[model samples]
Target: MPDDCRNIYKTCRKAAGLTQEAAAERLGISVESLRAYETGQRVPPNEVVELMVILYNAQHLAFQHLRETNALYSSVVPEVRPRSVLEASAKLTNRIFLFAESHADRRLLRITEDNVIDASERAEFNAIMEDLQEIVEAALELRCARESS
Candidate 1:
């Protein structure tokens, strides 16, 4: 996926080699509706987005859709960059290795050993959470890569 694209919906549709009419027809929506979505004049519903995901064979778009539409979801869901399956797998493995080297498991255990996150441990706890999120993002990317294949 090109990072410069203004809209994932538009980008994916183009990547799928779909004209607006064809994509709209396949998605069971009108061309105007799809144009509205692509132009960001309206948010596509989850179901329509799901259809696009299947039609485009682009799973990452689902997450990107949610993140783009919902503020809370956007805060929680990591932005998964599109990559080849091999790249995704390598990224996931690298994340796991980095997490292990950080000894986050031991740190987490200590932080929760007393069922409380002490002020001193807060920074480390947050850092560990970030590492965990990176792992999750990589996993999602791998899944997306497989679907795209």
Candidate 2:
């Protein structure tokens, strides 16, 4: 698959132990259509992607497709690089440790104590939020990897 294809649609199909013709038939799509999506020649609709996710038993594919296709999601969501369950668990543990060591909980409490983020606290608040997002992303990735397993 081309690197620019964004999501590994084809790879996921193959990983599910299916050939092009077989997967296409299961997806209820023409082989040419599936090929187009895999080759980056066309973007598969959300429904088709959803079908692929279920048919392939790959939850990560749904998240990857969303991240790649939705501009707002792409901007705000952390990129979830595919990794083994072990790798994802380690990443989550590291993120949690870093967050805890940084006293983000205290900072967050202080920042929101007044139910508002004053200008002075905006940067710190953003950093905490980003850290939290990383933790969530790691957990989600782990779930996806476990599902595939």
Candidate 3:
């Protein structure tokens, strides 16, 4: 996860003149935990990442990488697709879902405990993952089931 999207997290924190301690305090996390996130050793949950977007004034970063369905109301949702997808049937939505999957893999998520996130956000993240999973599955189906249809 080195130099990954979480770099945006570290850059934004520094640009805002907040040390890791300060930012972690605002996010209700330990400085060590925040360091883990910045270093790409641990991925923060969506709520923590969302809080960073607000704190860092870089909402676009969330839409670009976080795949935040909540960001639809946040005005940072990208107006244009930022990527080209191999699955034409899936397009940007499937690409976004795959990015989401890549960013928060279960192996990576094992480092970030479930208790760090609240019940509501945990539920929301689960729901979002479920929807993204559906999108990804559909894309796979189309890719394997049909060719130049």
Better-scoring candidate (lDDT), 1 or 2: 1
TM-score of structure candidate 2: 0.90
**Whole-model alpha-carbon lDDT for candidate 3:** 0.60
TM-score of every model? 0.92, 0.90, 0.43
- Give lDDT tens digits, candidate 2, residues 1-149: 23765448988898899998999999999999999998888889999999999999988888888888898987877777678989988999999999999999999999999999989999999999999999999998898878877
Clashes of each: 0, 0, 0
What's model 3's lDDT at 93?
A: 62
User: Best to worst by lDDT, what's the order?
Assistant: 1, 2, 3
Residues 1-149 of candidate 3 have per-residue lDDT tens digits of 43545466787688678999989998888999899878777778788887886776554445544542344543532232222234535563655667577765553365446546565457656755665555654454344324212
Q: Which stretches of candidate 3 lie over 4 Å from their true place?
A: 2-4, 67-149
Scored by TM-score, the top model is: 1
Instruction: Give the runs in model 2 whose Cα sits over 4 Å from its true position.
Output: 1-3
In candidate 3, position 39 carries an lDDT of 79
CA lDDT, every model vs. true structure: 0.89, 0.88, 0.60
Candidate 1 lDDT, 63-143, residue by residue in tens = 888877778997988998899999999999999999999889898998989998889999999999999999999999999
